[model samples]
Every structure is written in C-alpha cells, then in structure tokens.
Target: MKYSELHGNIDRGFNVFLLILVSSIVFLLLNIFFYKFQDNISYFE
Candidate 1:
C-alpha cells in the first residue's frame, strides 16, 4: 500500500513537470513568431 502511494505521488509530480515544460516551449515559440512578424511589418513600412 505504501509503495503504491509513493508511486502515485511520483507520477503526479512528473505530470506537473511535463506540463510546465510544454507550456514554456509553447510560450517561447509564440514569442519568436510574434517577434518575427513585428520585424517583417516594420521592414515593409
């Protein structure tokens, strides 16, 4: 019983970690895309 409980906690932690990693990657990609778009608009002006 104790081992199962510990394993569950580890799984939960790993899931949270993965969520944060994915969100950060998405945020970075969004920022990069926006930056490039802004640069292109400014160049066209």
Candidate 2:
C-alpha cells in the first residue's frame, strides 16, 4: 500500500510538471506571436 501511495504521488507530480511545461511553452508562443503581430501593424503604418 505504501508503494502504491508513493507511485501515485510521483504520477501526480509528473502530471503537474508536464502541465507547467506545456503552459510555459504556450505562453512563450503567444508572446512571440503578439510581438510579430505588433510589428506587422507598425509596418503597415
């Protein structure tokens, strides 16, 4: 039972880590896209 509990905890931690990693990547992509969009707008002007 203790082993199972430990395994469960590890799984939860891994999932959280993956979530954070994915979110950060998405945030970076959004930031890059926003910057590019702004640059295009300025170019048009």
Candidate 3:
C-alpha cells in the first residue's frame, strides 16, 4: 500500500512538471511573436 501511494505521487508530480514546462514555452513563444509584430507596426508609423 505504501509503495503504491509513493508511485502515484511521483507520477502526479511528473505530470504537473510537464504541464508547467509546456505552458511556459507556449507563453514565451506567443509573447515573442506579438512583440515582433508590434515593433513592425510601430516602425511603419
């Protein structure tokens, strides 16, 4: 019983870590793209 509980906890933690990594990467990429777009528009003004 104890072993199973430990295994479950490890799996949950790993999943949460992956979720965070993916979200961070997506957010950073979107931010970079938008920033470039903004710069281009401003330059044309």
Give me the candidate number with maximum TM-score: 2
Q: Against the true structure, candidate 1 has what lDDT?
A: 1.00
Cα TM-score per model? 0.96, 0.98, 0.84
Per-residue lDDT of model 1, residues 13-32, tens digit only: 99999999999999999999
Judge candidate 2 against the unseen true structure and give its global Cα lDDT, from 0 to 1. Answer: 1.00
**lDDT for position 1 in model 2:** 100
lDDT of each: 1.00, 1.00, 1.00
Candidates ranked by TM-score, best first?
2, 1, 3
Error of 3 at 3 (Å): 1.0
For candidate 3, report its TM-score. 0.84
In every candidate, how many clashes are there? Answer: 0, 0, 0
CA RMSD, predictions in order: 0.4, 0.3, 1.0
TM-score of 1: 0.96
lDDT of 2 by residue, 1-45 (tens): 999999999999999999999999999999999999999999999
- After superposition, the stretches of candidate 3 with alpha carbons farther than 4 Å from their true spots are none
lDDT of 3 by residue, 1-45 (tens): 999999999999999999999999999999999999999999999
